[model samples]
Target: MIFTTKWYETVEPAGCKQRQSIVKALGLALGLLFSGHALSQNLVTNPGFENGASGWNTSGTTSAQIIESSGRSGNRLTHWSADSSYTVSTYQTITGLTPGTYRLSAYTIGGNTDDATLFASNCGNQNSQTAIPAAAWGNWTQVVLDNIQVTGSSCTIGIYTQNSDWTSIDDVNFELQSPPPGSGNDTAVEILAGKGFNYARIRLLVTPPDSYALHQDLDYVIAMAKEAKANNMNILLDIFYSNWWADPGQNWAPAEWFNQDVNTLENTVYNYTRDVLNQMAAEGVLPNMVQIGNEVNPGMLWNLGNISDNGWGNFVRFTNSGYDAVKSVSNNIPVIIHYAGVGSSATSWYASYTNNGGKMDAIGLSFYEMWHGTINDATTTISSLHSYFNVPVYMVETAAYWTSSDAGSTTSYPQTKQGQYDYLFDLTNAVKNINGFAGLFYWGATWTQSNNWLNAPDWQDDDAATRSLFDSNAQVNPAASAIVDAGGLSIRGVDISEAHYIESNGVEYLDN
Candidate 1:
């Protein structure tokens, strides 16, 4: 995580020459470091405008000028015309560089008029820009334009503003970034593990039609399970038992099983579940917990097992078949019955299934704040479910946005990085407070717009982007720290039956 900035200028800018010399002397005397790198130098000249706007180009009706006592460092550059509206740009062009990816960053604040951007262009790719939203008018926010492919040996980096209010920029930086290690998948899992997540939850679809979008087939899931094992994490395998996305409303049977009668469909479910687990076990990646049918509040396998249409008897039969299959694979793997939300309806749904002789080792709930109730509601429901069923309860899926975009209903949180962090911190604490709450999982932690399988509307789509814990560049967001901190807290009612069994048997669990 070290950054090295290469300063191209040996001479200080005009007005602040003496001050710059003093600062440099102090830095050398104290053995100061830049971005944690002792030898790192800034590639942008007069990055802080301490040199009186030297080594910079300005265009438009009003020229950008250096302003005193208003910078993130010593001084800053500002584009403001109080008398009239104007468009301006303060840019610096760096040339004669090695051809590779580079990152440009700057600290900026104040833009209430029109939109503005911190941008990089002509670096051997399409122009890259990070917009400074109109609401970013007071607090200083770090804006970065990364992954700038410098193919032509040069790139233009700067801020372009079309505003009547005002804008301030400081500490501009342009640095060459080394290529990342892998496809970013392994790094993402590692990041989650480092942040205190002990289990990796993956959804598996049976006989998916498309290989990309609905790609979590048996082989794909086995590969993912191996990855999780390699990362020293337990796996929670959620079997959808359908050919495509399966949720409360759309739990259709797979195409192959669509026409089967109720009795045959039950056997098919058992066989499919057993075969999936067998494959994973053969690969040495058997899941620590197996979820039979995801978010099946309405029942799984469609009409054949639909509780309303076919009665609780058929639904219970289908569910028990899957549960029996899990036991057949290994009695050690706990079985979880997943439901979509919290409340009386969900409680009654589970009650009916269990009353009809359905079996499960745990209860899983998808608790999204917008769709489900508040944190208080979740805590109450989790406690009730655990008490009623005498089984462990897990918040198997939850998420909050780090950016204000169209993901779903509005949340009490501000939809910013800090807002997301606060929400998760509060939610985690609430879950921990409830006795017997198994654990919590942040759903889609590694999802991003670039995930081809997601079929994002466009590059600008926020459906997945807003809620993902990682940004488009694969960088971990601030909310990850919340998860790390949450892991440190103790849950009062965690079930350690499996752990106890492992210890009592003298099993040597080796870290992969």
Candidate 2:
């Protein structure tokens, strides 16, 4: 399979038709180059400068010409040289854009001068700017001006150089940054954060170097963490204990851990957890909450930690090892034990693990309406867990569909745009009504790109076509408003109340 993970592809019958549509859509889109990227249109004309600034206007001794093979990407790049006696610049005016946010980006390989700047501006005060910091020549540097709001119907994007030697730019991109029409006007993170959401969840894996979005790697995770922090949101780092997806059906170990004994495996888990956290901390993007293993209801590390085979002893040992490792790096960060199940399955697993001395600060649950039943079911189960175990519960992963197909309307919900909104509104309200339920994280919120996985040997799962908050065009769904409107207060700190629970005559009890 070209794609490494398909956890979102429901094995249930309802998902079969949806997956088929996704596969068909992907095949058609790939044949044209890309199928799902929202940036299908590069609004800038002659953006690569292969046409030698034909679409751009110049000023003041500024000469713009294309040099073949000089671009960091593509075949040609635009080279700019200034006489240094006055300001020299080049610009292109873009029209017919609706009022919303947009981004302008370009790559430059030379220009050690500090007087260079990139800008997006036009009538009615829509001006965004980015200063290219001083750096070495010959090494390509990316310059971007993001979050530039357009109040008018059009804008002009360009680069200005004053008293600078030379700078070659390529792959200039300027496009609508807002989600496609009907999706919403704001980013999912921005919308949710405005609604008082205090944290964002990011999952990481160790293998498949080129997973879509490079989500499994540390660099991507850290970058996401930085963005979350900038949004005033905390982070939940979910470490999937596998080179690929680690779920109930399969929990394959990383290549380095293969052939290792129980003791060695334990050490590996401990050290890996500690080092990952340490790196995150070093980058100043440490998570407030970390899940040692994702959906570890079946246990982790395969047979050794498999609850069905080795029982709770081995599972608890592995859990505690990870817990201790997390503490060794950052003592204050809360560790969570995530699992998939509700009702007796949830209660039974917790009972066994806690009895065997498994240590976790919180409990994370993956609750999907298709698999976990109704809203009432989730609230009731969460309430029961909190009442019994006295720990905070988070719906770490959940998503509902807007339309059943890429363009068709048919779904478990209303299948209309509003139906999508209502589902999330109801889900958020239900989670908030539960005392111990903190918040919910919609899975695959920004997976709107296509890749080789969409080709033959298809896994038949493309989230951008279904559960993602964005549509195939990368527009935010109306359902995103539910999160935008939900004023979630941060409750991520230590729950002192949980520590005060009591037990009498073998009956565990807690009074809030």
Candidate 3:
């Protein structure tokens, strides 16, 4: 539910200056059947412009020309005007496509003062354009235009720079991208399961504001639980306890429950949790583990459960209500208290919760290198938490970027496939070495460059596209191997059925 933005400066045809943030829309145009088969051939002729634009058409006030010794591979196409501002375009029309979705990609580097886009137009659906960041100069950055549905037989693919100082493009490629594989059709998830991914962590929202992207309703959760069970994977249901996103910065109560007093709100929380679990149980898809609330380090349900304003007493009361509900339905389901990030703040958050008599069977933490400290720091924090709390520790969420295009900040990893693999491998080893470490889950393992949801004009672009286990092509990347090898054979020694239990009518626990 984290969002990031990349802005682009565009010049309108009416001589108007406009600045817009890239907001990617979720889902594709309906009724367009995309085959799962991908075409490996690069459809663009003279893709690198090494042959001096043999198959390209250059147009505009300042014509784009091919230059040697500047291409990402051999020769790059560049456009610039020192005398005055001008527009230029280097393009090619691809015909006789297979009538499916296509992906256009290219490496670009140029000055920040100009507006440039790698675009695809005249296809079946609406035109798609990916802005080239102004700061991408001096370094080759790959930009992609995905989900180009080709209902016809042709599409225009090119790079256009308008009213600019200088821009350069190289190694342009246009190829067909396979559609998302259906359940049991996703080779990547199957591979992860084969490699040792026993649990699938799914987040549920009460009623997501954006149903297309943030949709995690009860039906959705039940369906996912059924899929995980079918795949022989355990389920970790993460309840956000809010209508929309619930993170450290914002955990607003659902609109209906926002006005309730403390006692009323506590009862509401218990009833809601019990209802959700009861439904899941009826469908024979009850989760193996349930988190009371996601990343509640800042507390949930706003003023009623916001520890900062109302203190831990109210927060603990709400949390215990949720814990009680989970136990009411099934004693086998272990309750996890999830906290975001790791450091002194995390330690203090847990300490305060435990001191307030909060109930939890496991400690779950979210670790991202850019937000949290180093991997070693995470390991140290994990060991400390386990030692003090006497509960199993789980790396409930973690990921590394396989590309630098959307990576906001720099890290020790190289932002390559291998770098992603290495980061995960080392972190898994570090945590596994700890005696109380339970397991790990790679967040967004199946997220791809296509179907970007966080792209509404009000929201920022989805920057986590490159952090997925799959590449833009929807193929499993090398980083997935690290996850498969790290915990493929190890099993934690906690039994959901016998380790803990609670009376059906009360919150008191009977420890095994």
Candidate 4:
């Protein structure tokens, strides 16, 4: 069968039962081209650019085509597919139809093994989209969304497939008997961040068995990326080279690569990094910034981990390999070198990596104070490194807990509320003092936990309450609120004169 990545068609269902009603409606209002037409009640003539909700959807977050404003060029439909596992795309959702009219309609091209189902239902109700064969997979036909009623904000949109092949969706959008205002534009990120949160981080996974920090949880990795992207949040994707998960303490090799030679292993590592990077680029899911290695207190790829003279060569090759692999996909994606902070291990690792010509876009560190050392010591070391390394530094992983009993005790530092508050305030302040420092990343917010998920009947609290910026149920904690709202107390040596402003609006012109 032939595969197509793109196709644009004027796909409107052709039928007798619907034409008369549409004609009646059209007669009442002056007819105009969809894109240009703007009725007093309806904003845009064609709100659903796809023209049909075929092979795609606009309901729920996951397993649906994403709807985002294409910058300023109106709205857009983005699909982040890593490979053949996913296909089909549309940016259309239908609602507010009359009692007699169905909620969804679509025109599709044939090539499908079975009839393409157009699934839909009224909003606020159970969503179901069942398709009527318009055309085959290679041919064009009109598909009507049935079992739907026009109701408030509720709309059903999705796809039903019988053949298990990559699906293709094109020009699929809404078919409202009468469309609404230009369409309210709001991003999930703006919505969430408005509620609080300034930065978002997504974890990217390598192959299985040797997974990086994700521990081979590729599904969660994808889910997290989708969630952050949908929220329109800035992302810092953390990458680990191992197939499973790897950090300073554990960097287990995948069972497959166990027997491979060091040279072959290095190449394997580079390829894995590059392949995932390329996949992310294609999906447009690549983070604003990418961290090549996580908590490399010892080193990454093992081949370069702990030899004095051999440190530079192995470190250089390993880092450069990952670096080159990423640059090969998109050079603009900044690469960060992450280390453990407070403790001397991370600092020593950085000394080795950078000395061996391992280029770093950003110098990142993780410090828990309890695990590493005193907040003052960690922040001071970070500040000194900024001046010495001539590179900007940031607290990549640092948290000021809020009444979390599970958190390790910092007896000398005190575990009271005020102490927790003081720790965060001081630590953040120190980050502010570093010259090249960007900002602090407080590991972050917890949405829903194991105890209180929608399906878990026994899940009582629902608020997992680990290291959440927000409380158990997503309520803003004092620490997070204090930082975003008050800007917290001052850092000893921190100079945020540059951060005070937007800093070039995050854009710069090239001389060349």
Candidate 5:
């Protein structure tokens, strides 16, 4: 008998329950889609802040001022300008709500604030507050805070800031989530398995105090890998090799590796990589493949390891150190070098790396349709890379919007749900048509509305990947079905099912 035990992924709180509950609600809704009825009514009055903050209780030295027609949805929004360096907060009591699960959300933009939070708390008791840190500057962002448990008939929803300046909020929403019958049968990993996705790619940071706080630490990545193993999913461990998000723009060495010479830095990479693999192995969730670094187009480790600033020799040495560390753990585990860009750009980057003796089992590319040109351009680039490197090429990062009604996307594909479905559907075919093509992995899996929620402080990319498998409400979207429609493609000896259903403790069971 194939016992398919349901496994749940636990989300560690960085600040509030937004990360934990929103993701859980979406996964739960994935199985309840066909049966349950959601009785949703926007409980908060003047949710869009269009009524000039009327119905809200404002405190502190600051005021909740209303600005006409300057919101996320192009409607009237409330602006709180902190000209003075003082603390201020605003709230509204939402009454007549039944004791049940609820989600409170708002769109906010903050600048030069010590800290800003959007929360939903019990009227009498502030201890049960479900909140998230808000900081979305330069553009508007939709902040969806789900999985709020209301034990009473009334809850206080509001925004609070301390020594903050220039923050605006709009589209405040608080709604009850009514679950359909016979839910909880499938988890997020199972839903992905059903949709022909077997690989779980997790990103790891050496010391991510600046990003994810306690969220993306080593223990968290190990927990994630163990959960993926329980679901019989393939693991692709992506090492950032930095203290924060490791891209060409913001890749910095961890504090321990700071001021180290080139040789010392190389040794640090080697030791860190080996220790990570060893830690993962101890948890019984060793990765099948490991990524050396993330999107090292300009180079990694900033001045010391960056190829552009230092030279090709230093960059190659750093990469080879990581590669050797992976092999030291187990020769069977494959190493991948990832880069962002397509066509001649990709070719030129690979040439520099390989010419300097960079060794990688496979090549990964970030082929966002909007950023990397059209599908034709991707096809040409992939073909050229394979011909030159003679190695398997795959899309390590790719995504589109499910609906253009929110954030406007310009990939020649319509912003509608159908457009999202068709984008991945066609992109899958394009990859499969090429010789030596490996596979594709969506960039941000749980992304729904705004990509601004991804990182904070600097908050780089503000893409609302509405094309995600789930919508802003955490319910299954049409783009998810599109992935299922693509089914599975064979790469080398590994098929989608095999990838997801690898042997666990000397037993392999094909789920469904």
Candidate 6:
């Protein structure tokens, strides 16, 4: 009867609704995964941009720069005009090339308005367009310059400010390619495996087993856990004190405990949490991460500590006690505090809560397109929030499609594939201050049809919905692909940054 017991791991008849549902969903996902495309390691490396070569600028260049005799420890030490800038002093050499069709480009960073140019021919054959300005800090940004002909052996290449002023230049590179390529999955866990995703965030509904009123969410958890282990995943069990949903508003105590005093009930929460965690401590198993309560903004475990006057005290007691119990059982696991808020203003939110002494290991935010607004909106919010909290923020729970493609009268962006791509990028970009960022977790890898628990007619899931990286039909959506495929979700986990991530070459991967 215990959750980790695997008691229900039987290979039951394929005809059962539950089993059938899983198989169908898994198959659809597989079909879509295999059908997904892949990205090529399209990189550009410049042969120059080092040691201020002799014939570099005078050969044909723009100058508004000087060089620094000393460089940074982990970075290239170089300078342009003015005190120092990435733009301004890009040595310019213009070349002429015969008429032809081709894609040309360079990856740069730093100069927000710097525009490096790749020339066509020496007659200044009129083929110099603005290369997107880039300023290198401690990272990389690849910029593409498309369609140009190499009529002569070489023409001219120049790096300069957007307006031909002073700027800085750090690491520079060049590359020629048709386009970038991307990959797909062929089975359950296959694609996710490919994406270097090595963990899963699962939710558990802690209920007395004898209570038939409990959510079968436990059933879903076990099913997911087995699959997760099979995929070599580390789990983050989000245990909600409620039999169903638990949040600041309704941290419903178990039905049996309704009559119990707040003190006794609070102890019950601690004891029950410890009991559950202890039971799950087999095979080096215990949640790698656990969230004590869902969203405790207004506070949780109501009644005696109903957030009246000494609400903070009560909340602290409940949480600290819960924390003590968890630590007593397993001292190493990290606990997260989650919340639902608009990304538009993370400062005003966390400044008010976290700054006020709310105990939490990490700050978690749920940025849903339906609620928090655009991808850009969410991103800007995170950027500001990070500065204020000086703590990490996880794009904890987010989903795009309200319904499978109905694109409700909602204001969600794109409402299609392009929209999905932009939304994901927006999130990643929003958390540019990456080191402290954790990861983004999609709320539902769920699909609904007819009138089941998951089915919500009002919830339109445009194939564009960036929920599970795959749709209800099991097709690979852009979100999942973009995650590991982009650059390994640095904000998530390090495991996602390796080659042969989830799986490779017709075999599964080990939990590295």
lDDT leader: 3
Considering TM-score, where higher is better, how would the candidates rank from best to worst? 3, 5, 1, 2, 4, 6
Q: Global lDDT of each model?
A: 0.67, 0.62, 0.69, 0.47, 0.63, 0.48
**Model 6 lDDT per residue over 100-129, tens place:** 233333443354453333322221112333
Q: What lDDT is obtained when candidate 3 is compared to the true structure?
A: 0.69
Q: Which stretches of candidate 3 lie over 4 Å from their true place?
A: 1-184, 405-407, 451-455, 487-512
Steric clashes per prediction: 3, 2, 1, 44, 5, 59
TM-score of each: 0.59, 0.58, 0.60, 0.54, 0.59, 0.52
What are the candidates' C-alpha RMSDs? 20.4, 17.0, 19.1, 14.7, 17.7, 26.2
lDDT of 4 by residue, 323-351 (tens): 77778777887888888766555566677
lDDT-wise, the better of 2 and 5 is 5
Q: Give the number of colliding residue pairs in candidate 5.
A: 5
Worst 10 residues of 3 by lDDT: 496-505
- Model 1 ranges off by over 4 Å: 1-186, 451-453, 456-462, 488-512
- Candidates 2 and 5 compared by TM-score, better number: 5
Alpha carbon lDDT at 453, candidate 5: 29
Candidate 1 clashes between residue pairs 3 or more apart in a chain or in different chains: 5-41, 6-41, 436-493
Q: TM-score for model 1?
A: 0.59
- Badly placed stretches (over 4 Å) of model 5 are 1-186, 210-214, 405-408, 449-467, 491-512
In candidate 3, which residue pairs clash?
A: 24-455
lDDT of 1 by residue, 16-72 (tens): 111211111112212112232221445888888998778887766445344667677
Better of 4 and 6 by lDDT: 6
The weakest ten consecutive residues by lDDT in model 6 span 1-10
Better of 2 and 3 by lDDT: 3
